[model samples]
Target: MRYFSPSKAVILLLLTVCCYCTSFSQTEKKHDVIVKLNGDQLNGDVLEISDSTIRFTYTGEKLIYNIKKSEILKITFASGRVETFNAPPATAQTTPVTATGASTAERRNKVAVLPFTFVKDGQNAAQEVSDEIQNELYALLSKHSGVYTVVSPRATNVLLTKAGITKANMLNYSMAEICQVLGVEFIVDGMVTQNRTTQTSYGNTSYSDKTKKNDNSDDKKSSGSASTSSTSVQNYETTMDMKIYNDKSEIVYNQNRKAFWNTADAYKNTMEYLVKRCPLYKK
Candidate 1:
């Protein structure tokens, strides 16, 4: 009979323990599983639930993924928590704006839409955006009958110019000073911001090489090689903010909205959404 030494027994025990741990780690269960409406399953950890969206992270990956609630069928968590999503209604009810109007005394309030302040890197394009925002805001407000008497963009520009509000001196005045110069009890000021970014990624590559000998013989051969690749992704973001101030130079309403597209139509939609939600635009 062969006898094993104590040191040999200890070494064997350690090896067995290590092997067990490695096997357990390899077969560890997933933290959660997400079932998409399209019959796909994603195994990952559910990190957050907000904004009608779910943030999930795949096992062993640092990248986080976002899926809208509308796309998810259900989520099964490791701890036995299951969440289901119901399809959203096709048309949500639009509440009528019945109480957003000012009183009879307040209806006479005069409001001016000033040249928007541009927070950007370059001056040439910033000026254009500023002018566009000013024009759009004036147009929207002017169309709102009896909400507030809106000052025309042309007249507002003349008042600003006469007040020495050149590009050089525009940033030096306070909201009260601007209101005084525009001769209005309330004013609408805005800031426009745009951020654009791009990202590049590479996918798996495959290479193939082949060699053939000429039928005529000799020591000559020909070789051929081929390769394939994929494309990259690029994204952009833009944001705009609008604020309303009263005679006391206090903010009465403020809103900052952002969008992902960098096109003129996207900007227009953003402006529309923001303006529609303003306190003065109800009903």
Candidate 2:
């Protein structure tokens, strides 16, 4: 048997107690987290955080939510270490959990489509693409059985512009407004870009310092000037990024897709691709 001296035993006992105390203290320290919901921010202690949801206590209520990192306008940690988490899982939904067991069946059905933003950047004529995209979308949902029974472009445009979506969005709009625009159960909005170039020839000229300016101002004309023609085919380009929102104005889907006019069938090809990939297409 191994025996410890009196002093050694006392030291070991103290060390064990110290380690236990440190561990308990760490576990007891409340972990702070800030959550933003429906344009409201709440401060609370985090009881659990997982891939699908967060469990927190705030305002004297235990709340559970399905949220994306992007949905969180801001999150401040007690340790001051800021981190970005993943977006919500595709199947995970945002459902309001009521601690008081109250029913919420009277919410309005809202939706929106951000102005199909024109890809004005680079060499794209965003306005043209915007018009075309709007036309295509109009054509698509017009034929969908019940899709347009809720919202239309005319209505969406009026409502969206009122919500300050006159230009491209950098978080300038809200989900609730978007829901109102679409008129359906949700809303879809996105952006686009396109570019092309042409070849041309211009007369190049040179002049002598003394005689050219004084005598030949009218006589010099364009030395090699001749009637010439330039060719610039109408090339097209388009890119789109989209997001869907629920009545609460919470984001449901976010994705980006692109298209360009390289061949005669470019428009058809691009539209087909977008339709196949768009969530609205399936809806």
Candidate 3:
């Protein structure tokens, strides 16, 4: 067995104490992260956690901050433990209860397509066209909606009718209210305008002339037959305005597109273009 003198034993004790302090200092360096409900993150030491508030200090600063637990979304501790705070209840304007009593939180990742509003020559056309566009849009979205549940047009229309939400009265309700009623996280609304741009007329004329007396004389009598035909084509210019809103009534996407072609059903192309580029669209 090795025996150390008093002075050497004291030195070894001091070294062990130094190593322990170093290890403790390294552990203390690890930060605790606080995530706020508004999406802000704070990195620092958590001094204390009270029932309603948390005491914290910035990583490099000594000034302590006391944050209400209600404002914090969660906290990640240095030891890899996570604590989450309850989210504040949404208000009526932000997350209204639906007819089925489902809250907006229950509508995550769901989408609803509303009946389009169609106008032709500055006058509101029949609702038949609006319903047609709605069905078409619903079909397109249902086919390509990645990670989103698209409510069928039939179901959406039924719900809207039950809520007394027609194209004329839709504007009276907030987007959040509409989304809640449809039980969807997002809603797609569109308006199509079609106006006659120009009328083009094309004609073709054909004439045949025969000189029977040309064999006898150069300036003999001549007979001619003529036929003419004309046709008129009407060209239209179409524009589509598309908007997407979340359950919070925030507009996530808004775009106005004009059809590149001048045809009667040009709005179809414009509508497809908007859908393909909207935020919910995925490869």
Candidate 4:
């Protein structure tokens, strides 16, 4: 065993004492919940505490948390006030805004279209299709009188990207947040699949005896002599779904349409067709 000199022993003791003090100090601190599910958060220390709740600051205001409703994920306390741990709830909490006449009138018959998402197949093609569909949908909505105002694609793009949603497989925004942000009565969101190729061939020419035995007395005529080459042109097909909601944010109508484009001039044919045929036009 190695023994330390007197000075070295004193230094070691001091270090041990300091570490013990640090551990003791950490165990005695407590922090109030700073942030809540809603947009509310505290900027200052918690001033009061109870078995089930704590009071924290607002804009020079103080608010109380109902321990039952307030999520307690993780908390470290100061002798009683400063906290520094995240308490993210496993689920979301919705706080509805009561409808006043002013609020009701302000949101009357509004609509917003979520930014279209493209399902990436390890290529940029999907994004292109997403943009193409979104633009066409916007153009269609632009001409309608029955439809409420559509949220700008730029804003939708920002929100969608912030959510880390890079694909159109689903809309990640919750109904509450979406309606809250856009103040809309309806939201139209869905995916877009670009051009597809389908081929059908009739009379695939072959040299089988059954196809060739047209019993010429002198010689057997091969099926290749009667073979015909046929080809069909494939076009872009699109399917669209639109959803309408009432003030309560309940979906009232879900409309779907599928349209086909002509092979010669139908790169974006499906989107144009939906704009013309969508019921939103008459409404």
Best by TM-score: 3
What are the candidates' C-alpha RMSDs? Answer: 32.1, 18.3, 17.9, 18.8
Runs with alpha carbons beyond 4 Å of true place in candidate 1: 1-108, 119-126, 199-235, 260-265
Deviation from native of the Cα of residue 192 in model 1, angstroms: 1.3
- Tell me the deviation in Å of residue 73 in model 4: 9.0
Error of 2 at 212 (Å): 53
**What is the C-alpha lDDT profile of model 4 across 72-179, one tens digit per residue?**
433434344445334565443223332222355666666556655443322345466667667677777767736456666666666545444345323444554455
Evaluated with lDDT, which candidate comes out highest? 3
Q: Tens-digit lDDT track for model 3 on 129-167?
A: 999999988887778889999999899889888787777
Q: What digit string (tens of lDDT, one per residue) describes model 2 on residues 1-283?
A: 9999999999999999999999999887555666453455656665666775656677456665455545664566778765545343443223221121212332233233445665443643556556567667566644542433435567656655554455545254455534433344666666555444443345545544433433735664333333544555454454556666666767666666556555323544555565556555544
lDDT tens readout by residue for model 1, 1-283: 9999999999999999999999999898858999888788999899999978999999899899888988988899998999888653343322211222344345247788877766544333557777877898788767763656788888878877665675555556666666766767787877776645665656767767676767787656656666778776555466778898876688988989886565534566777788788766645
Per-prediction tally of clashes = 1, 11, 0, 8
For model 4, the stretches where C-alpha displacement exceeds 4 angstroms are 1-102, 119-125, 158-173, 199-237, 262-268, 276-279
Q: Which 10-residue span in candidate 3 carries the lowest summed lDDT?
A: 89-98
Q: Which rank order by TM-score, best down to worst?
A: 3, 1, 4, 2
Reference-based lDDT, each prediction: 0.73, 0.54, 0.87, 0.54
Alpha carbon lDDT at 239, candidate 1: 75
